[model samples]
Target: MPCPERHVIILGSTGSIGTQTIDIIERLNQRGYAFSVVGLAAGKNVERLAEQIKRYHPYAVCIGKETEGEILRQRFPKVRVFTGEKGLRELARLDEVDLIVNALVGAIGLPPTLDGLSLGRTVALANKESLVVGGELVTKFLSEYGGAILPIDSEHNAIFQCLRAGRLSEVRRVILTASGGPFLRVHKEELDRVRPEEALCHPNWAMGSRVTIDSATMVNKGFEVIEAHFLFHLPYERISIIIHPDSVIHSFVEYHDGSLLAELASPDMRIPIQYALTYPKRVETGLPRLDLEKISRMEFETLDHEHFPAFATVLKAAKQGGTSPAVINAADEVLVERFLEGGIPFTGIASGLQTILSRWESAEANLKEISSDAGNQDEVILSTLLAADRWARKAARYLSF
Candidate 1:
């Protein structure tokens, strides 16, 4: 009798979480954890991906663009190289992979996620957009397909660990902790004047630009609120967000029995990434442990929805349920990119979502009907969501002016 090595396929293999996952796997292998890299996928970072393939020696590699795939195919002739969205789907459904680490950003992460789960593979999910855009569809698919999703986001991962202390029924409230980004203290007038460089300078965590900008607007936390609602089967009332500038207490879950449980660790992405890979069984990663005494004090502030209007928009979208979240998520994504490109002012991010949402409601009230009428058929639901997403992105771009 011997332990089997877990074969992993990492989507977005060149991004922040994907790179950290690779680092953890290498670290864990040194500590005698049996794991293998069977496949790797990235967007357009062929050079870094090529470096990864040489080091890890995966059997399959896929890129978003066919041109990059051709280059990779020539370089690694012995390895299987795939191209485009179809290739990413093919990579997820590969027969050899046991775990699919979907660290891919944006709504594009949704399809391969559904593919992996349909095949009954463990999905280590770092893509919050998957849940944010298609939470109902994802839950329905999981109910039918019988796979597992381990949260790789620090906040959700912490809440997941905290919820284990008590029965789900006994949980009263789950509090999500935010670092408040870099503008926690900026006055309202100054917010509109903040530049992309200032927004990208997150106070606590290092992440991709899209996510960093989302953090500045508190929309990242808003999406987390929706994510928690679906992941834990908790109502919006039970989910709360607080500004924890220290970034030590990742999240907290309060029980009905007057007990609160929290998960605290250094704001290291690798910790959650490693935990998601080897869940129900912790392994040594050789990272620094949390030093409690060195932490002088922890402060928590109530989220000022007025300051970050994106939070209010997320709350409204989550409550509305049908295609509302998809519209808002798409709008937010476009606006974040526009802000980064200096095409819009900082305040335009929130205003863009509001305008797009209003226009969507006016143009296609039936979209919500379609979403709500789709029932449990995953295909129909997903199609409706995709249509809504496309419409929102187009509308948001128009509203950006």
Candidate 2:
């Protein structure tokens, strides 16, 4: 019997994860696993998207700008082209698309994720914001629509694997390993003077600019903690983070019996990407294998909450359990962009998040008396989160560090 071809739509096709996912799909095809790219979506990287379209010949594609969509349509007249967030949703709901690889960054990724899951399509998710900002909505979709979410992030993917060692009832706690970014040794006081280039210099991973800076601030790790909570159905207290500079051990799950099951791999995003694509059946990735014998040292440290205050602030919003996470995510996105543009100091990222979150909390407290319930209507939840996101971005712009 021939292998069944799995149809896939990749959001963020020009991104680091999206390109790597394409590479994995090609490799899988060569290895007897049938996978086809049916749709691709990208934001502002038309040149790379064009190359991918030329190679893959996707059935449909989406771009951020309408002008660029016109260019793509003229270039590839046969391919259906769509633009902006609506395009993302259209590509996600494409008929016969077996999987939606959501590698999109920021809250923009959330709506398409909800769309894919609502249609009962499997989603290989790299966008942590989907869970961070809309975990409740995503959870509702999964329960009602009978879809699956395969985590593509290293830590959550690792925990997803380790959880198979025992049942969820048998689990005690899950430990997420962090690489401590490029500034583990830098003093807290010196962080305000740090440059964007310096902050983006990750020691273990090659990721997009936003993610690299989030890792430096350890905000990315906090996002993972929230992601794991939703993915594994574990409470926030049961999920933990630790600094492991080696990036060798991805994550760990501890059983009630005190046994710890860990997923270890060399620091490669493609490894988790492949696992997500091929899940339950490991295939040859041709990527470099982890050789534990060569360098025999692995160090672990407790996360310094004092040094990386942004992580704690994010967690605080996550604990608030409403639109707070959306606010934090949106504010961070704006603040990080400002930092990268040299408009704010490195420490401004954390300070700015603090200001926005504090304002959100105060506003929410005041509105609690008159706030009407929105119930669980998906559209209402989406609109509410989008409102919070817009408000945060606006607030972050006017914020002074």
Candidate 3:
């Protein structure tokens, strides 16, 4: 019997996760899985986007700028092209798309996620910001529209697989493992002097600049904790993070009966990416297998809050709920950029987050009386979060360390 084709639209198509998704799709197709790239979207990477379009020949595509979209249209006249943030949402809501692979970075990825779920499309999500910033809204959409989100992140993907071992009620707690990045052994007093080049050198995984820096500060791990809370419907207390320097065991699920289930694989994004695409049906990936014999040893350590102050700050905001997480995420995005540009010291990221979050909390307290009586609840929530996001970005830019 011939297999039905699964049509996929990949946002952030030129990014690390996005490119690996394309690789997995092509590999799947070769293995008798009918996976087709129906659409591709990228931000400001016209050269790479053009190459992907030429190779895969998606029916429609989207780019960050109108000028780039025009260039693409001239090159491939028959292919439909959409532009900007609105274009991303349009691509997500396309009727023919079976899977919406949101590999886009930062808060910009949240809206398309909501749009895709609004029509009940299954989202293969690599955008942690979507859950970190708008988790409540995302959960509401899932409940109301019956959409699904399959995590593409390594930690969450491992948890998703380990969760199959037992019922949700029977689970004791979920553990998210962190690689601790390049600063694991650095003394707290010296973090302020560490250069951006030092933080970017992640030992385990190849990722984007922002994410790599986040890993160094352990802010990425904090984001994962928030993501896990939403993905597993677990309380903040039930989700714990352990510093596993080896990056061997992605995550662990503990059962009430004192048994632990873990998903182990090599540190490859392709493993999780492939799992998200062919969920409930495993297939050969043609990638190198995890050789535990060669690895020999794995070590785990407790997360030192003093060493990674950003992680602690992020979690505090997450606990505060409402627009707090959005503010912190937006602020961190700006701060990371500033640090990479040599404008701010490495320690400035955490201290800046603390300052901005305190200011946001103070300002939010003043606006407590304001009520959203006009629009839909979701609209009100989305607007509120976006407003906080904007405020944080502006605040972070002018903030002096």
Best of the candidates, lDDT: 3
The TM-scores, one per candidate, come to: 0.96, 0.97, 0.98
> Given candidate 3, what's the lDDT at residue 272?
93
User: What is each predicted model's overall lDDT from 0 to 1?
Assistant: 0.90, 0.92, 0.93
lDDT of 2 by residue, 186-253 (tens): 98889989999999899989999999999999889889989998999999999988899999999999
lDDT at 151 for candidate 1? 98
The candidate with the higher lDDT, 2 or 3, is: 3
Name every residue pair that clashes in candidate 3.
none
**Weakest lDDT window of 10 consecutive positions for candidate 1:** 368-377
Q: With candidate 3 superimposed using the best TM-score fit, by how many Å does residue 55's alpha carbon deviate from the native?
A: 1.0
Question: Judged by TM-score, which candidate is best?
Answer: 3
RMSD (CA, Å), each prediction: 2.0, 1.8, 1.4
**Residue pairs clashing, model 2:** none
Task: Report the poorest 10 consecutive residues by lDDT, candidate 2.
Answer: 364-373
After superposing candidate 2, which stretches have Cα over 4 Å from the reference? 365-376
lDDT of 1 by residue, 1-401 (tens): 44479999999989999999999998988877778999999998999999999999999989988888989988999999998878888999999788999999898889999999898888999999999999998898799899989999999999998877889999999999999989999998899889999999998889998999999998899899999999999999999888999999999999998898999998999999999988877877788799999999999999888899988988888898877898889889989988998999998998887777777777666775666655556777787888899888987777736
